[model samples]
Target: MTAVLPATLAAVDLDRTLIYSAAAAGDTAGLEVVEFLDGAPLSHATPASWELLAELAGRALLVPVTTRTVAQYERVRLPVVPRYALCGNGGVLLADGVRDPGWDDWAAGVAGRAAPLPELLGLLGAVAGQPWVRTVRAAEDLFCYLVAHARDAIPAGWLADTAAAASAAGATLSVQGRKVYLVPAGLSKAAGLLRLRRLLAGEGPAPRLLCAGDSLLDAPMLLAADAAVRPAHGELHEQGWTGARVAVTAATGAAAGEEIVRWLIARA
Candidate 1:
């Protein structure tokens, strides 16, 4: 018989990983910011997903990790269940609606080393003039990102240039779906999770960490997990997934999220 695994924690990406963004491949009716499906056909989540998440919520801590700023995340208005949340790419941490002070300390420490927003904005300004970029905007938190027309719209070298510039400034940049983001190198989802682990798990041997996402930006958190899951689509899937335990899911939105929860709950 196989050895049984210990209890585990599930760290999930909010946007593409759990909830579907309002912007569908062919549909742009509600792409103002980001939209979530409550019960529509193109909705990113389904009833099954809610049931599964509720189950996991009971068994393991379900952390909603997203790049959206704390205020932006508030606009999401997800079903209010008690769960820890990390918003603004780990810039702010909240537990059951209250801001956690420790996370602010961690954010300050990370920001102290990251490149300033001015430098990144300058590069983005140059890139914005390119024909490929339709619109660019800064998050309420001051991070920069752009809505590009397509992958081929911008020269591949532009991504390289941005990465190089970000590197020089000690920052990190990534493009996911139609949007690109400039995040401080040290303020990553993995780092935020580690801080939570330290607070909750303490010095005891770490419990298995289960994570899932769909972008290269998610690679660090996925790699750090004891087991990880990904959908058949997304940047990570296109490049091929090769590390850690993985659950390959269907390409559809809610279906993929349901599959991830199923896989994690089964393992737990």
Candidate 2:
């Protein structure tokens, strides 16, 4: 009898990591549109990367962990349907295309331990009239974020000041690209992944974890993984973030997406 290998859990971030917008696609040509808005092309991945992702999905439990809203996440057309997905920065979990009620209850408990979303939203409103602030919205009813017209135009010390205030209120702050996120300190991708891991372990031995991402929000998830990979671009790279087991791709944009998929497949 042959010894069975433990399962592999590959959790990957979507935007800027596995997929890119036209503005971020770099030199990659023949892009496949992965996301559309009102029938207009919005996000894309290289044809090669798409094919590689299909192969990876067949090999491991492919979990797309993203900060995108549930509706926004459904817009992306991946070659394979993932068994599980964590969206809204772990605020929502989808199991077999259905929202898991148990996870929802767990998330509600986590939210209860933090400052209420309405209060955080009120704090955000105070700066919504700033010239550089483009739009402000609540994400999945769990946190809030503001879009800036230009990343550099954001007021000096605003991020630090807001982060400090949020911390005092039991929230956390992160600036990824042109978006500033104010999420609850008790809610994180790592926490969600750990819950999923426990649920998955009930079927058998725990799987070996591999994670990939390109933003500050991804750091906790990456750090929680047994092995992690990050694209050479995006917010994390911009801040020179790294970990003991984190591997980086040599390329940027769609090419980096391809490299990450290949790395996952090889490691799996």
Best by TM-score: 2
Residue 122 shift from truth in candidate 1, angstroms: 1.6
Per-residue accuracy of model 2 over 1-268 as CA lDDT, tens digit each: 0133248889999989998987788854688888899989988888888998989988888899998989999999999998789998897999889998888888888977888998888777888998999999998888899999888888758888888889988998888777888899888888898788877787567889999999888899999999999999998998899999999999998889999999999999
Assess each prediction's global lDDT (C-alpha) against the native.
0.72, 0.87
Query: Could you give candidate 1's per-residue lDDT for residues 1-268 as a string of tens digits?
Result: 0122236778888777776654432233432223434534333465566667778877776777888777667656454465578887767888877888777876877866866776677778787877788887766344678788886576778788888888888788887777778877887888888777766666566667888887776788888898888877777777886575666786555567668879878877
Per lDDT, the best of the predicted structures is 2
In candidate 2, how many Å is residue 224 off? 1.1
After aligning candidate 1 to the native by TM-score, how far in Å is the CA of 263 from where it should be? 1.1
- Runs in model 2 deviating more than 4 A are 1-6
State the lDDT at 67 in candidate 1: 86
- In the predicted model 1, the residue pairs found to clash are none
Off by over 4 Å in 1: 1-6, 22-43, 129-131, 140-142, 149-152, 203-205, 250-252
